[model samples]
Target: MAIAVISGCAPLIQLDSDAQPSTVNQVELGQGSGRMKNEQPLAHLYISDYDSAAVQNARMSGMKLPGYKPEPVVTVNHYVQSLMHDLAANLEILSTTFSVGVTSFVYLDGDYQQGDLLGNQLSEAFMHEATQFGMAVTDFKTTDYIRVTPTGDFTFSRDFLELTQQYPISVVLGGTLVRHQGGVIVNARMVNVMDKKVLASAQAFIPQNVVHALKGTHSAPLLQLKASQP
Candidate 1:
């Protein structure tokens, strides 16, 4: 049997909580700018970028791309699962509860050239597995103020933010993914988009074997993510 490895939800955001948060061995919350709105404090996560020397090498080494091959599916699955898991744990540490939101662009497939044709399917798969691990999406959305493209860097410019009216977003989450020294590194960050302030951040390193292996199904270790305060 095969499960749908997709990411998707209605335009409307929703969140369900099971506990008060902060469990033993939980990630610690750091200081952040108190710019989040009281009502709709949302964190919209976007795919920062996937272009890296290591990823290129992996592709050259035939790491895997979107195809019928199980290897590609597994590789893409692991990347989304682990990164979102760490991103959730790290973000919750700072605020009592954060509504998680992801953009349609996060799952980008660069036609097998430089990026993963990563889409809602991949995100859905990741979300399903991430729930078993830890990550949670409370509820969130982006505002008309900004438009985040798949640029190498997160841009905060008037060209995008100015074409808006009321900005409903609380934060924008994004970061980098790269392979180094046979290991893959994932970084996640929550920023107060309107205030130009960083609320929380997390960085983690995954083992090469763990990340590169694509034959068997493997669960992502709830490895501790290095969190940074504002």
Candidate 2:
């Protein structure tokens, strides 16, 4: 009786096998499996030969997506370190024994007396790097008196009136920034204060993108205006 029961289901299994392919094809091809406009089978879509042309076209287009090309990872600190490293390599008489000071980098075309935020930041970064390189850097911006206020306790000031007129700096490290189309060229040098002689010099090019990455809080009038509108 069990053998007879198994034999009865053999024809039903064969019928299901024949219908399975047709049902799958109908679902994949969407309603009309053989009457579609393109009439290409699903297997043909996965063929390498059919996709070769598309792959070649994409290659020939030369499309550059953002972050596609590998760029050298860098920061303001890295650039400052590079400049200091070069300066160290080219030092004449400057060493750890000499007390050094860092001034803000100024624009090459400007009067050289005033500097911007970027220049101030570059000077600060150079100070940190100089200390790491074993140079004794003097903080001339520190005041003899600390101003204690409700907001915070302040010991540093840029005002010449607050700071002492003289510091024990033997060497001063300074730089100039020249803006170009692609980026800015930084020219850095260590100078003797008394004799006014250049001790060591170095230069590095900072890409505009990297420079723009420096973050700060500032007012954006255009953005404010847009936000105020409908």
Candidate 3:
């Protein structure tokens, strides 16, 4: 099934500096920093599901309905991945780096919201998007932890560290979708998992009224999450 939207629940993106904030300490490349061309570039990256503070509050709150199924994060992993492809293409980095994870992904919806929920989990939609995008992706569990600042900075949660031990990912893609007074702001980033450093980042502002129209769907928000880039 689609990601169940909760009123005022969504991730917020940080929009500041050429660098995106991360819990991982920022690393500056010195004159001898080996990350230059001809060196082994960090190519096998991971793209994570976008998340927000509002979504977490609802899930942690103890008074939800029995059938309540909160979309833990903004359901836009594959979309963000597509954005990554665009980023790499524009930056001329795709030839050097690409995602190195499963092409097939599986969903873990803890609640039994639909009789055939498995048939319609957000993962299915993402799989379709991946196919359409011609991205070489496969089935694997994709879970990431991130925190955001009031002004739109990103920080990796401690839990995300545990995940690194299991996967060989060194770099990742992340962002936030925050509900604001006017509209939503997307603070997307390409992050280094090892040092929690931001490599490339961008921000987009989505008008609130449009979000309202999409939210009315009450279905998978992923089906209608569209943001602009410049």
Candidate 4:
């Protein structure tokens, strides 16, 4: 009944198929200057920090510091589940005309107690979301769920990439869960592994009220996050 969610193989910096970094050719920039013009290819650039208000709001919604005291396990479970539900709903609404698959989710942490709970919650969320989009994930059991953490002095682990290679999933999800500014924030990034391109990115800012519910006291927050079909 108790799974060591945090006891994953190893946390390694693995690139999803779509996210494999492409070589960027550099050209000298400026007159008589040995600097490369546009030295960083726009493709190699992550987080361009565009002018979108929604994205800006997400960026501005900073993290809560030091993290709140670990709440009741039941409360954390509920909040995580609710988040999965909302995410699924949004995916369904967006998958109308586009081909979508709720494949796998990988979390970053070393706590198996917390990681196990989070992984189950995420799987449930993905399933619910898949239904909304009229997509059925056939290999849930075979699907890879990973928790990445460091060991000793090493900064990354090898098990992390192994799972990715095994699953060879098309959509990869990664992010963090933190308490910030009086609430819980789940910053998630969804990437298309095949092409190594970022398909969609989102940040869920659960206000204090939602946090209370997440802790088993209040109602789920009403934040609408819908992705348009490509």
Candidate 5:
């Protein structure tokens, strides 16, 4: 018995049940026969409608030019916020149980008592973040009485006599700054005033560009000096 199979638009293929299965070397078409010379199948190639030049030009036009990306503008507030986030995560004590105070950051290599404008700014930033994070903060510089003078009225004072005699701070937030070639390294820790045990600690790096953004000199003073000289 012979079985006939038709596939798509190709000619019919006949198989005999009594004959042993064998390799097909030739396939008969309607008017011609295609011969298979080797086991490898032949590939048919056709011309496409796409233009290589047009595709290349389109890809080049969409590609961005190679250059350095503009560095993000970071400030003291940003660095302090990052540090505060890390510190908050490591805090083991309850915020309600401890009243916190922030001090000016000191340089690692300089005298611990002396600090720069950057340290002062960092302290201020930390104070703001601490309050925002629901921690009770003590403003030791705030005076008990507001001083009114012909110059101006002030509630905050550096004068120890005018300020409160004592602050109810149980935890002190302080840090040290290390100057680096790329940036400044800030190491912050919250310590118990009674035993000096650290409750939480955090560290962050400020980029050189951000640290350099701080203005060191007043232009008004320089202009006044120049005018006086003339």
Candidate 6:
């Protein structure tokens, strides 16, 4: 279930003013009448870009797919509520293992692909899982609409890191979801905030049976999913 369109890049790290001082002059922090005397560059804010063949081509060809529905901008409330519930659950679970406090989040590839509503739908489910685990999740969808730039990239890791450093989150998890073989797969990597190192990487696989259930049937979620962890 690899739904994400993969792109290549060098290993990522947060860009800082101290590391690249000239970047400060290049930053556009919105418009203003007068420039402030002292403006500090934000650090630990990671910027990333996500490009998917599905989304790019869908926009180009003006094509739509079956079982696809555009999410209404005016009424994204239901999706938000669903996301909150899932996020709460996820945070709750992490709390038992870690501190499980999340201040904010960013969705990199949420735009529709092939008229498919996978991104938003998956996010709602993910949020629900996070909430169930007992975490404080931010409303990134409403508060911040992380856009797909012309270069087809966006950044959120730096912000994630900053949150971790400030709040001293013991562990931080980040990942992507993709459609693969008529199903969906989520690949996640958990890192130690202090060391800034990856602690583990896991893949959540959704089988064909589970995918059918994703279409709105209650066919015993993950009933046939078998995984091994070390």
Poorest 10 consecutive residues by lDDT, candidate 1: 1-10
Better of 4 and 6 by TM-score: 4
In the range 150-228, model 5's lDDT, one tens digit per residue, is 9999999767887778888999999998877677889999999999999899998887667767765562210011123
TM-score: model 6 vs. ground truth: 0.29
For candidate 1, the lDDT comes to 0.40
Worst 10 residues of 3 by lDDT: 19-28
Tens-place lDDT digits, model 3, residues 1-230:
01222233222122222322232121223455324233433223222223533224434554233233444444434344555555445433432234423121211232323222212232354345434545444333433544456877444332443344465555554344454556555455555577877666655554554444343234644323345566
Question: Would you estimate the TM-scores of all the predictions?
Answer: 0.32, 0.63, 0.32, 0.34, 0.62, 0.29
Model 4 Cα displacement at 137 (Å)?
A: 2.5
Please give, for residues 73-167, the per-residue lDDT of candidate 2 as tens digits: 68777889889999988986547888999999998998788887678888999999999988999999999988999999999997898889988
How many residue pairs clash in all the candidates, one count each? 13, 0, 17, 20, 0, 47
lDDT of 4: 0.41
- Span of ten consecutive residues with least summed lDDT in model 2: 1-10
Expressed as tens digits, the lDDT of each residue in 1-230 for candidate 1 is: 11111122211112122322121011112355112223433344322113233323434655432221222333555566666666556654644344334322231222322322223333344446534544344223223344556764332332443444443445555554554565656555666666767665666565655553433225433222344578
Model 6 lDDT, full chain set: 0.41
For model 2, state the Cα shift of residue 57 in Å: 27
Q: Which regions of candidate 5 are displaced past 4 Å?
A: 1-72, 217-230
The runs of at least 3 residues in candidate 3 whose Cα sits more than 4 Å from the true structure, single-residue gaps closed, are: 1-86, 89-92, 95-139, 142-165, 215-230
At residue 168, what lDDT does model 6 achieve?
A: 34
Model 3, TM vs. native:
0.32
The lDDT values for all models are: 0.40, 0.67, 0.39, 0.41, 0.69, 0.41
